[model samples]
Target: MKESVSHIQGVGPRAVEQLEVMGISTVEQLLEHFPFRYEDYAIRPIMEVQHDERVTVRGKVHSEPTLRYYGKNKARLTVRVLVDGLLVQAIFFNQGYLKNQIHLGDVITINGKFDRNRLMISGGTMKTSNQEVTGGLEPVYSVKGSIKITTLRKYIRQAFEQFGDQIGEILPHQLLSAYRLLNRRETLEQLHFPTDTVQLKQAKRRMIYEELLFFQLKMQMFRKLERQGEKGQQKRFNKEDLLVFMDKLPFELTGAQKQALKEILSDLTADHRMNRLLQGDVGSGKTIVAGIALYVNAKAGFQGALMVPTEILAEQHKASLKELLEPFGLRVELLSGSAKAKERREILGALKEGSVDVLIGTHALIQDGVDFHHLGLVITDEQHRFGVEQRRILRNKGLRPDVLFMTATPIPRTLAISVFGDMDVSIINEMPKGRKPVDTRWAKHDMLPRVIEFLKRELGKGHQAYVICPLIEESDKLDVQNAIDVHHQLTQVFPEFTVGLMHGRLSSDEKDCVMNEFAKNNVHILVSTTVVEVGVNVPNATVMVIYDAERFGLAQLHQLRGRVGRGQAQSYCILLADPKSDVGKERMQIMTDTNDGFELSERDLELRGPGEFFGSRQSGLPNFKVADIVEDFRVLEVARQDAAKLVNSEAFWKSNDYEKLRKKLEEQGVFQDQKLD
Candidate 1:
């Protein structure tokens, strides 16, 4: 089964190259390349076929075939045929050679669209009585670049014939019997050439269960490896000191914040290293909760590190955290890439000598030459921005330190479990007291004057505004407003106020400069793209006007809306859109209805589907061949529970019942560096 695809009969060198292009270099890979859809080519009677319906009909050729040449090497072949004693015309495109083979009174079958009114079948394939049609649920693969469907089908058939007996079952016999599922051999056979609908459904169910079970088992094993025998620092901090620190804060901690802090503190005191994800909506006071955790870590006489995605966010956090923790005699330092050479050297020295209790920076914290004397806690803000490898490198910088990943994007509970199953999760759902929900409204493009008037009134009160556009420049395809155009128009409309432009095309320093101007209130209105969606905090910006709001996903729209409502003044979010589709209209309506990020995320998942919900890049979801995280969530839950149970059973690991699973996991390298003990 591991043999190269060239070993298969009729697969020449050129065919091997094409199969390799599709990532099928081995017999096993070729077998696993399942078809995306199937075509039903069951023969049907012409009298029973409806108008403009796809039907496969058998007929006898009554008229001679005529070939006509059209523009640019295109040809049309038309022939009259008699089906069910009714005369009908069958048309084929670019198959001029069929004219020489098809003849009068030849029994033929065609599969294509049947026009009942004209008694015509266009875009049809014809087969004579001597040729085989192999009709009934024909598999259709996603082919690319000269790989014909018939050629792929032939190759797959030959592969099954040669390697069918070599296939082995990965799932245990007990599971197959308990689930009443077919064995691996039968599942593959039925998936490729299913005999009936029932068999196809059963085959798909088995594959989905197997894929999800393997994924969940991997996650469970990772959790075990991180926690088993991994000793974490038992911080010896005084409770009175923490209480005194909390009391000094200007605002009281929300209930949700307190709950999250309690969880973190419990993890810090435990003997096992902590790997947790702290998630919340924007302005939900998650930063404060993280600040408290950092302080506790500092009080334990250990160093702490906070890594963010951008220099602007790092700078913002440095200021706020210093104001919060500096008074308590915990030194907080900033180490960004743009820091001067001498300043960077000083910060590095302080970090290594234990002078910097809490160091905050961008990705520079993970680079070389930055060593820690007693790094106890590692926290990453906008956790999704950093990849898995980056986080692992930072974790290796210390001795099994406690890690807390913070993200302002509120993920739905279902997605959170599937993506972050290896770690504990804590959520902060409450906003700080005295923070009002931003008033949301939806308007049409014709209502721009009213929105501008509202913006003028808000700016008159010394408040700032943000105008978000979908595109940076004019697009030949999309007719929506662009940032540059909007900036110029707004500048002319408000001559007394300053308008700034910022987009992805700008340099990092330029972006920081623009953001700084906005933060200082020098730029009254900042017209930009979604570059400001993450962690650029400007409290004075109370108004958010999103142009072409329907072009964005619900989660993104929610994040953009969160930019405002940070200040004491009442903030407003205005959506300018005239959606033509029902889903787009529903999206605008949903945004105006609720301000809860979690609720919006759930709806967003439903509206955009799981693939587009978080985008595969940021979702961290496994790419399953057969399992859909959303449609097969029930199966996923069952698989997760079973995986947890199996990993916890010590006797099972030592028993014969585990040999097959152990072998399979070993083949997947799941237990490479893992200790079963």
Candidate 2:
């Protein structure tokens, strides 16, 4: 690869600037810019090109191209090509430049999908060629508006020709031979300019394997460090302490919950650091499992801290833990950013002196002045909500504290192994007995009145409801309904009932007051945004009415539905969305068809990809340029096994065979702020 893309042939300064917009500044980056889709350039006769099929046809222009205008500033250019006395119409939308490029009786090849009528090929690639077939296939890249596909293809071809042999293999020969993978040079060549579908598939597999293998290597490195190198504070606890706490609970533990608790307890007793992820669906009793871990830590004469994303969640955890464990002589304290100065000082003092056994709070727990005496366990709720640095800071409070991360979001096993590969994972798939599935449905806008009546009936039955909207207020930019407008509308529609409004724009105190009212059932209807997606848990709220539901992802819709169905009463989730697009309809149907969070999560990953699956702000997900965690699970397994084999070998660490691999991992920044010492 050349030092810069500009050094390559045909990539001038302007071309370089445009390429940089697509994240290509170097020749290697240009080579790595794999095609997102492919076009079949195997030429077919003009009459044989089927409708809605992408194909390439070479023929002579039978007549002069004609340009016609539709609306203001909109024009369509039409040209007819003749192949063996058969005339085929080819239309290009807004491509007036085609009049100057082609003329009467000019031979050319067109690559695009035939329109539904099978008479014309619209919005496709056009190149001047006398041959019938351009090649076996063509690479179609994702390009900027100003950069043409032909330009990108030309530059990339030059890059490969100039430095193709210079692209050396990074993987060891033995490993490559074992995997039967092609070298980098061949992979890049086939991916960009493949001769057949089989070659393309083989080259794609090689690249995917390389990406996943390197990612797995880094993750395993972290795992090995945590298990073999990091020292953790091992706490000593009597079995009776857990039994006593279990006996005090008002409910029975499910088998899954018991298994999770057992695994966490086993980790706590181990000499190595306990870095485990506790994954459970909403209302699956994860908090109780965490409560048990905290109790065990306290019983061993150590302090444990639980961090949540919001103050309301922190408060809920603190209250619930205090009620459950205080009878067992455990002192629970709540600290958050919203706590008063006096309260913060008091809590800090008690925490430093070891009087507080379990502390539950938000980011305030990791404040500079906050200290813990013999801090042993750290539990973080909604693991993705916090950054790695934030969690590290909390862990740094103690001398290698045993860490337990908890997430109410049900992650698929494949995703769990990829994202949280460094941590031992424990899943609580079973809900406690008596929790019924929420009845979910999607309705059109015309069904709003019926939906409102349904909510009224639920509210009349002594239950509460949540009315969620996509926006906070009216926006000229977006046509979706807003929470504030919905709140007023609901208030006017149901004058006899009390409706409350809540959104991110509200102050902390206002949010707390509104939520408190809703929880106490003082507000029969709570209208809010996705801000209530996480912390607002009211058992009496049996109905969730999400407006513009098509605008929400499946995972978030599942979370909103989880807000209901927490009590003995039957619950319902009514999704109101305009199912105009196929994607919209598909998402709505998925929400209505299943209540399984794990299934929805997997489907979400499939439909929306990883970035939107958990959301863009989600941390810890690997940024692989080619590998997809959902589609490449099989490759990931192969890579994971290979990484394990390497990490297990004692000689590999000191041998020169893995020095390049080690340096690559170090340069990847996968180990953030890790001390080499």
Tell me, by lDDT, which candidate is best.
1
**Per-residue accuracy of model 1 over 378-479 as CA lDDT, tens digit each:** 999988888877877787889888999998888887667765677788988878889999999999999999999999999999999999999999998899
Worst 10 residues of 2 by lDDT: 668-677
For candidate 2, the TM-score is 0.89
* Candidate 2 residue-wise lDDT, 379-426, digit = tens: 999977887788889989998889898887877887676666667899
Model 1 TM-score, 2 decimals: 0.89
TM-scores of all predicted structures: 0.89, 0.89
Q: Candidate 1, clashing residue pairs?
A: none
Model 2: how large is the Cα RMSD against the reference?
3.5
Clash counts per candidate, in order, are 0, 0
